[model samples]
Target chain A: MPKTKAVDLVVVGAGPAGMAAAVAAAEAGVEKIILLERQAELGGILPQCIHNGFGLRYFKEELTGPEYAHRFVQELKKHPGLKVKTETMVVTITPDRKVVTTSATEGLVCYQAGAVILAMGCRERPRGAINIPGTRPAGIYTAGSLQYLMNIEGFLPGRSAVILGSGDIGLIMARRLTLEGVRVKAVLELMPYSNGLNRNIVQCLEDFQIPLYLSHTVTEIFGEKRVEKVRVAPVDKDFKPIAEKGFDLSCDTLVLSVGLIPENELSLQIGVELDPATGGPVVDSFYQTTVEGIFACGNVALVHDLVDDVSTESALAGRAAAAYLKGEIKTKRWLPVKAGRNIRSIVPQRIVVGQTTPLYIRARYPERNATLHVGDGQTKQQVVSPGETIYYTLKPEDIRTADGWVEVSLEGGRVHD
Target chain B: MTELTCIVCPVGCRLKVEQGKEGLKIIGNGCRRGVAYARDEMTAPKRMLTAVVQVAGSERMLPVKTETAIPKAKIYAAMEEIKAITVSPPVMIGQVIKENLAESGVPLVATGTIAGEGCFKPLEKSLGSE
Candidate 1:
């Protein structure tokens, strides 16, 4: 039988989100907090992301991924009451907040925690998910996987590659490969607009003179032993491939940066309700999910574009968990928040009245001079893109007049050129 | 007139630069930093270089970056210099690796710590490979 111990709080994963949650919980005076990470060391994916342009918001200074994570890691060292467990894989989490973890050092252990915070972050969508018709061959890797191989393991995946999808990682990897003497043939995006930030498009692809083909998709991949060439074609408005306009590009590797899905297997194990739109657990303003004493934040809550927002959101979850342990949180009325016109997704699907609630929203499409209508209050934005997150705080007074529900909509804007 | 996207921050303001009678004129900038970014980008572009260097007697690689942005044209040359050098372990983060990288006048420094052997284990193979 595995040894069982009681703890005040148990944090799963040690990424930016998990690390911030643990640090914030400890700062709230929660003693005997255990942070579990499946990897050998901490910092999660930040260690492998060796690029600049992080920490511009939270720290007010531009930093690399590792540097941004190291700032919080240094804070984790200050709390002696926090127990950080590395290389610990959490196998199951029960509804009653029982956490079961396994590791080589500590074979098997069970922790009955007062509150459990889900911060497992997210995972990359691979080739199988997108159904790119291709010969099952080697030399195909996700953008993130390729990044880990080169930046961490110091191995080039291939000499030349064609990257599909202009997600930030793909764009960044295009430049990284170019700097390392790899020939990046081009970046192809099925959508008319890229899902990555504008800065990434300008610096990573345009800076390196890599051609970006909009409304283009890879129709077929041809290679027996390794990826040798791929057939790409332009897409119509309906996203169907135009076979006549197809062309071939020779490359040794195919890097996919299509999308990222939140890692919520553990969240599902405990039967936490999920939002199909966000593909993550639905939470309230306090970052607490439908299940009592369980909180979700960061990518597990919703895929955020920036790590700065992840740290801020996870810290709220941590403090809320601390409050839950002290019995300060009460179940009151939760107003259903709806996504109206032009809104792709909004976090905090439910919110309690009488508190300043922050809402994170993503537009369905890029628009110019759009006005965001949240309940009775409204704000204007010069430009809003699906690639960027829109942050709005609903004041207590603003929601007081709400008749049991709040709707978020964008109006008075045309599609951006 | 030249058009560019400001990469100074995530806001990513799009700017238009043109040579006016006075000097250079920038428009559509959301902040002051955007103006400076456009001016520098138009005149002499610079970018921060980040790469991994091999650590002697270990399979681990230490991540390093320039203290500041260097001239954009010298990136490949700077990468060559980075590839030619190797450092011993027991190195701390922020330790200077080179005083001036590719004559760009920016110091190259380690961004991660590489402790002695037996204290930290090398990471396992990445799951990206099939």
Candidate 2:
């Protein structure tokens, strides 16, 4: 056993969130910051995502996933205070902010940090989780895993395939496979509307002429040694498969892009309160979790639809953690923040009303042409065209009027002003 | 007058389309993207496709995707042509899978890397043959 080293800040997961957080913390004058990643390399899921739609909102230019990640990696590299450990997995994070990790070089190591940030990102739902009954073969893979195998590992998953779920990853993969000289039978979505972006549905499926079967699902999978075929059928509003409407497609692969769940096992073990809605920890406006001195950001806090948001949020978390270490941020009491109609969840579940900071809330459902109003029952502030996520800044006066809790609600429709 | 649904946004606006003196006139679109979408749908619809390619001597398939949208009517033909092709390993990102596929003038491109040394697996038989 080697002697453990102590750092001012310990960041778990070296993806966009971890990398951004480390850089931000180091820039904020944090003398010692360590970034730990489980994979052999950094960049997380971005390396596998070779699409060019990223960085549009942040950088004002479209860049590939790898390119977007490269920008942050380069920034982290320039920060002398930052240390990154690849192929190191953090097994457990204690409530006291003690991080225990295992690595090939350092068998077992422990670190007690003044503040910790969890940026482990999210994981895709697998076939078993979705309850797709069929023979277990090597053909089925999550969209991200398939992307990695094809883009990073230089191996394709199959020649002909039926992709279940219209998630962005799956949609991107659908186009990726088609361009690779493979037959993409169709992209099936159980929802009446696509879960992915409208641009993806058009550019990926429509442009490719890949059939999109909405309100349909894979009823069963048939294969002896490898994927032979998949039985797809229409589903009712309640999502029950209509067996009579089933049709079998002859393909060798089934790619599942169902949904993503935030990776929060470490937070749970560290005694941080979890939000059932977001499946991540409940944080304050500063991104500090319920347990003081422990911060969380990125996909670990909530499943963001875009990687750009992950980097932006992680930078904030890193700044907050560094501030906390310097005793710059202190709050005695915080008020609970509640999600209103049509909102799936809100980050910074708690907020110190007097704190001069803005709160960010990301909605689970996409509301078209809607206005969001946030405040106590009597006084409210409104923002128009509130998309998936909206950030609101509360001044000292706005906080003074708070009766205890803040309510965020959606109002207006397409025609409503 | 014909009412067509625009799938550009969740709003799903029903656009009024009719032949006027100027040409196809479209109304009730939400954004610029919606207007372009209506124009394309009324004239010619295009789509992008992605699939895996069999890399010679590799167990792993190389992920490839289309760089541009092809004509809506030509998608099946493009897929047929893409399905008939295979590439060797050491394929780099943005590599051309098939140039000017099916004469649609859209290039099929590789989205990721493929290792040089691996066995190529057969396509899953579960998805019915075209």
Whole-model Cα lDDT of every candidate shown, in order: 0.89, 0.76
Candidate 1 lDDT tens digits, B54-128: 888766678899999899999989999999989887777789999899999899998887876652453221111
Q: Candidate 2: deviation at residue A286, Å?
A: 0.8
Q: List where candidate 2 sits over 4 angstroms from the true fold.
A: A356-369, A376-402, A412-417, B1-130
Expressed as tens digits, the lDDT of each residue in A190-281 for candidate 1 is: 99999899999988998889999999999999999999999999999999999999999999999999999999999999999999999999
When candidate 2 is compared with the true two-chain complex, its DockQ is 0.10
- Error at A371, model 1, angstroms: 0.5
lDDT, candidate 2, A251-309, per-residue tens: 99999999999988889899999999889999887889989999999889988767777
TM-scores of the candidates are: 0.97, 0.78
Per-prediction DockQ scores?
Answer: 0.37, 0.10
How large an RMSD does model 1 have?
A: 3.3
Best by TM-score: 1
> How many Å off is the CA of A275 in candidate 2?
0.5
Model 1 CA deviation exceeding 4 Å by range: B119-130
